[model samples]
Target: MISISDDVKVVENFVRVAQIIANLESILTQAKNLSLTAKNARVVALRAGDAALGFKPITNFIDEFSEQTIASTTKIADLSNQLFKVAHKLVRCSQYFHQMTLLKTHINSKQADAMYQEALKSQRRAASQLSLALSELENHFEDIQKQMQSAEYIAVTSRVEATNAGDFSDSLQSVSDFIASAAKTIKTAVVYNLSEIHTLRGVLK
Candidate 1:
């Protein structure tokens, strides 16, 4: 039942996964910059005396969240690379299987059908394993959602505390806003990747 069109579809899915992998590198770089910005914000808050006492926890939590963001993003990037490799390999396997079918169609020999069927079975097995890797990627991205939820909490807290922190309130607010914006980037990318993984899995099926 496999056709050239189906094979092309599968290859396209693999390319999308590779694209997502590429996107993660940029996200990580943004996270690193946000982390440094937060560190500087903490120092500014500390100099503001008792008026900025509430900012201590807010800035501390942001600092910690940024660290976790970098760690988890790196892990996700690694997973993406593995997923891309598997998906790309499956594309080649599918293409070869297609070529074998064209030969079988022309020869019209009983032996050719048998050979094609055997190769088809092997292709399906490889496809299943590759699909499982995609599932793992979705699960890993779910973990990132949890991480972003934590970051969201810290961002909200930072905003509220900065409001009452006096002369540096504007500066602190800007820091909180930037951190929240960075968290939004993480959230958007994770959602997009999960969607692509689902589509890629369907392509394999």
Candidate 2:
């Protein structure tokens, strides 16, 4: 015997939670970008010798900020998962209520029809919200992929600059290769997530 108000409240809460998760996902994407940029800068500074001595402290600060960002994102992900579970429970409760009403002989046809329509509308709205959340996550993944590619380019340019100056070293070459490989891996992951999100969206539609 859940009230309409209770059902509306549950939906509202789920929307709010989804929005929070979207925002946190955006922040995490930016953090990873910043981390990649910092790592590239460190590689550049190591090659530039005494001229780039002042960049070490800046690079260290960026690393610390990136680490903090990762930690915050982890917390957000945990909270989002818990909120999702609650939303699923609420949806099940709504379904049960509908079934109970259907079994009642006293309910008129018009009343039953109205209730069924309302339930269908609510379900559609929930699906829309979930789709939007998945889209946001996909965007975040794409942004990360772009950033990783940019980082790889920076790393390569730095290596070439160092080699031109007769400062080529095995460590610099290793760093360049690592950044390129990491970028490729991130791109693969993003593609997989995008496919998953696309499938979910299609099913919902």
Candidate 3:
């Protein structure tokens, strides 16, 4: 029989997975907002003619940054989903092994022994898969943090360019502020998710 402790562990794994997915969804929304702000900045720059020429190219970079962030977040979300599935399977296999252990005391010895061995094999396989998936997810989180740094750098550059936009300075500056805010939100979400993943990894170990 699966013990109460085993059930608690399974529930903890599922909770962690859900939290990470929710954080990722928040980051994705911020990234889309950043993209929209970039387009608005581009339009403002165009209206400013020669005065905002430098800022126009920066808008393109901002758009690219947002797109890249969106793509990376999507990948991470997929990995997180896969990790949840593997974790669930691992829990189920462990519970099965526990059940078989209990059965060994009441059933035919030979059959129980055979079933016990099979359960052991399945549990080991699930453990191996979960380990690999956690490693991959950790790597993806690191990649996301690096990307956020790049996005933040671009946001700073956009602010500088906005200052030189002549009469359109206010509009461009507003957009730059929005971009920076979005980048910060995305970075915060990523960092939070990464920390949670680290805790989960340590727990698994």
Candidate 4:
């Protein structure tokens, strides 16, 4: 039977994953905001004519990256939930050992051995399946990290391009600033959450 601490660790692991899901939800909100801001930036860029023509590509990249991040964040959340459910099942399967162990004294020696072997086999099977699920979750977490980095890069670059277009159009500059702010917000959101995500991954390992 697993120790109480081990049981708590499973719950802790699940909570850690849930925390990641919650952070990603926050990122998804920021990404959506950035997307809308990018749309506004596009309008401002068009009005600036050639003076802000360089800002056009920035808007496109920001919009696309936001959409990708939104999608990635949502997918990772779903995968985390699935992993938690599966892990819960493994935990439940394992708890059978504790119950069998309680009844050990009542059973004959041969029967107790047989029960132990059977529970051991079942627990091992559950563990193997849990390992496979965890590997998939780790891969999904890696993908999320890459997507966040890409989103951050696009935000920083867009801000630079907007600043460089400076004085070309005051309105365009304002929208550019908004886009940069949105990007900064996205990065800021990831900064605190990514640490938690990495921690969750470490626990899984």
Task: Give lDDT: candidate 3, residue 33.
Answer: 87
TM-score for candidate 4: 0.74
User: Candidate 4, residues 57-135: lDDT per residue as tens digits?
Assistant: 8788778877887777777677767767766766666677656666675676878878877776777776677677656
Scored by lDDT, the top model is 3
Clashing pairs in 3: none
* Cα deviation of 22, candidate 3, in Å: 0.7
Q: Where does model 4 exceed 4 Å of error?
A: 1-7, 101-111, 164-205
Q: Candidate 1 vs candidate 2: which has greater TM-score? A: 1
- The C-alpha TM-scores of every prediction are 0.84, 0.57, 0.89, 0.74
Candidate 1 per-residue C-alpha lDDT over 1-205 given as tens digits, one digit per residue, 9 for 90 to 100: 5676966786687689777887787668767877798788888888887878898877777777677777877888887887777777777677778877987989899888887887787788778878777777777778777877887887898889888889989988888888888888888888887788777877766
Best by TM-score: 3
Ranking by TM-score: 3, 1, 4, 2
Number of colliding residue pairs in each model: 0, 0, 0, 0
Error of 3 at 30 (Å): 0.6
For residues 1-205, could you state the per-residue lDDT of candidate 2 as single tens digits?
6668667666655665566566566556756776776687687777767755554454565566455556655654774565466456546645655664564446667777676676666766666666556555555556555665565665566456444433434544554455455456555544654564565454334
Q: lDDT of model 1 at residue 31? A: 74
